[model samples]
Target: MEVLGTIISVIGLIVHIIQKVNQSSHGDTNTTYYTDTTYAVVHKFTPQEKLDNMNIDSLNICYKTAGISGFSIEKARRTLLNSYVQHDFYIDDVIIRQNCMYIKVMHAIPFNGGNKCYGASFSMNFMTVNDGVAVYGSKKINADEELVFKEIANELIKAVS
Candidate 1:
């Protein structure tokens, strides 16, 4: 009887430890709050066999106003288009607004035998009555390339506000 009890206790302890480890690895259960509004940002790379047979990666930012359900796609598009044009980014397309959302798509082209690359980015900005502005930006890039996504996001935020 005593041996059986010891085995059961050891098993229980092991199960408890495993559960704790799993929870910790998945992040704390505590909630996190951001003073500034949060946005869903995505960066993706796609191989373009037609254009120089190179890869094109796009970075996108989706903005939502506080208390608003859907992302302001049109506002984001306008903001991005204006900024890109002012900065002389390659303007392949204008801001697109549809289905109560704004989308901007741009691409980067490689040159100098793939030694150099250039790209454009687009964003849509939404002005909130009280909370300020929200923006979504997207840009395409070549494979194995790195760009300042965060810096651009910050700049967009500043420009619209």
Candidate 2:
């Protein structure tokens, strides 16, 4: 399964590269370096979709905002970013992951195996960079009238209730 996963990742990287090269040949400069479709890709960003590259400390800051900790390895964190999460959703390098940040973070970083705190932070960042919105309201407000998180999580909760 690991070998299969690695193969898929390699293939996805190749496809992204080909797409990039084709776009460049047409005089398009939107060349995005993606490692694989196996990794989550950020579809949007603040101040336009172009990311200026924030430090890994930004992840820690986000974690801190959520009152969490215990993800210290800068190299590992940087590897996570560079290996996956491209462009402005990036720390650097090729993009990485599937839909779940939990699985990826849990596996990617060393010295902190199966840590929910680290995983959740990456998940949140993944969600934020991709869709970056949150919703809040009570039963008192009409569902349609309520401000939504601009993503599926908000609606899923409502549907379940």
Candidate 3:
């Protein structure tokens, strides 16, 4: 009876230590609060996704946002602007904070009414993480959107590196 009790206690202690290690590794989801907006950011990746550069989940896209080994916010901003202009996208707005930058891009098309316009907008955010950066954005999850994202991300990596 005494031996059985000791074995059970050891197993419990091992389980608790494993749980703690997993918790520390994954950590908590990061929350970003701006003056007018808030976002809950999490990284969800599969093993296969890590091996493929162009493949991403349907809901959203995220990248390590690394340049060489580190990241430079200023260089990222310039690359973003250059891509924005190259793609003929209008700038809705850009907000640069201490550790993050938000860029909104817009595309406008003429409506049937002479004075009215139809437009679509999307936003991309870059935030400093661990030793590099995390770049994430939302999209409609279509082929065209994915292509555009890849183009921009490639440009950013090339420029910063």
Candidate 4:
């Protein structure tokens, strides 16, 4: 019961290219997702707001680029959103919350199936969305290929805790 399974979409190798659209230039709708500053996690995203056009559009672009079928970003959106809204203790940062969402998607492969492309795109976008966090200048978080699934899950838990 202690070890919930963990899945990772390692970003190093992937086939699909996430159409590199400038998120900030997309107008007001996606601006929230591209904000360079961090925000405090203050509220639960409603079921509706969770799959807001911003995330859906981004995820859709990824899926489309990957040539994936049968997977619904809408469904993935709900599942990832639940990771935050339904959390037990508390996750404090909006950035971490965002990472939590992508990580869950990568790990769970909740869609009909997931690919290296999805994982790469989601994590890359998550990092970019949060001021390019832990992604540059020695602040990057590396994945330990040596870690067991349970250990990885614990690390993820500690990350958002």
Candidate 5:
């Protein structure tokens, strides 16, 4: 009778462990999501053959602006939309909001048959007191575009400075 009771207790313990594991495994199944609005602009410089003749580096600039408001989702969204419109960039897509505080900008520039290039991508949190924009290039960028990037950087610097 003692041996039989011990065996029954061991079986009960095993069953309890299995039940706890199963419950934990199935407890949280909801997928987490993130939201961001993407703005993109593409300019074709030359024909495939002409571009093939020249060397190119992909250039990209990403910057963040803050201080418009505290690090709130609503404020971030509003600032992002306003900035996109002010910059005159085309909005490609907007993702649903997640439980985070930040806005991001991504840029991609391709050259020379899209063979070789460099790019930049970054994000800014809403709590930031200053904003920043950057310019990245493979070899070099056009004087005009470079100037524009500088202007953007200056703007960001001013916001932060």
Candidate 6:
């Protein structure tokens, strides 16, 4: 069983490496924009020490200010909380600062014939940006883990819109 798990993990790593190479070859375009908008992937790790405790260390952040008019910080916070629950993410903790809300979440994925489960922990922040609200997230996940960056960004955009 242990050998099988290792094999699967190795395969997943290979696939991830291939994908990374392909992405880099194509100029590493990780964001999809709409209309005349700009998206930037900011590699800032605010919760590095904390996230490392949960075995998650990859720093992934996205900033988008398109289609956000009349943005309300409080409304975005509430919407993000609701969206997390509705998306089946287990909320670990939340810290509300002056203009930012920090959230920790975990998602469980059933694996190995549904007997074992793989989980990923995510650390994210929703803050008021100059143009609009911004959603920043970080999670260290392998190929078997679901990537939630896009979902978080989309949810935040929806809230601000």
lDDT of each: 0.43, 0.32, 0.50, 0.31, 0.39, 0.52
Q: Rank all candidate structures by their TM-score, best first, as comma-separated numbers.
A: 6, 3, 1, 5, 4, 2
What are the clash counts of all predictions, listed in order? 10, 8, 0, 0, 2, 0
Measured against the true structure, the TM-scores of the candidates, in listed sequence, are 0.28, 0.18, 0.38, 0.18, 0.26, 0.41
Off by over 4 Å in 1: 1-92, 96-129, 137-147
Clash pairs (backbone) in predicted model 5: 58-117, 130-160
Q: Which residue pairs collide, candidate 2? A: 38-97, 39-96, 39-97, 40-97, 51-88, 84-95, 84-96, 85-96
Of 2 and 6, the candidate ranking higher by lDDT: 6
Which lDDT tens digits does candidate 5 get at residues 6-118?
A: 99999999999997888677763564556777866676434343223322223234332334433444544454555544232222322222432222233333211232222
Off by over 4 Å in 6: 1-60, 63-67, 82-85, 90-92, 110-130, 139-141, 144-146
Worst 10 residues of 2 by lDDT: 99-108
lDDT of 2 by residue, 1-161 (tens): 99999999999999999988888778665545656558565565542122223222233212111212322233333445445432111122222233222112221122222322321112222233433322221121334221221222232222212
Q: Please give the lDDT score for candidate 3.
A: 0.50
Please give the lDDT score for candidate 6. 0.52
Report the candidate with higher lDDT, 4 versus 6.
6
Off-target runs (Cα >4 Å) in candidate 4 are 1-68, 83-121, 124-161
Residues 1-161, model 4: lDDT tens digits: 32332222333223122323433345446335454788889997753454352253343222101222333333434444456432222222222244324332232222222332222212213233322212111111333221222332333333433
Best by TM-score: 6
Error at 7, model 6, angstroms: 74
Q: List the residue pairs that clash in candidate 3.
A: none
- Candidate 3: tens digits of C-alpha lDDT, residues 1-161: 99999999999999999988887788645634358567776775543343233222321556336634556666667766655443333444444556555544443222112321322322233443454555555564566555555554454455455
Best candidate according to lDDT: 6
Stretches of candidate 3 off by over 4 Å are 1-60, 78-92, 107-130
Per-residue error at 128 for model 2, in Å? Answer: 86
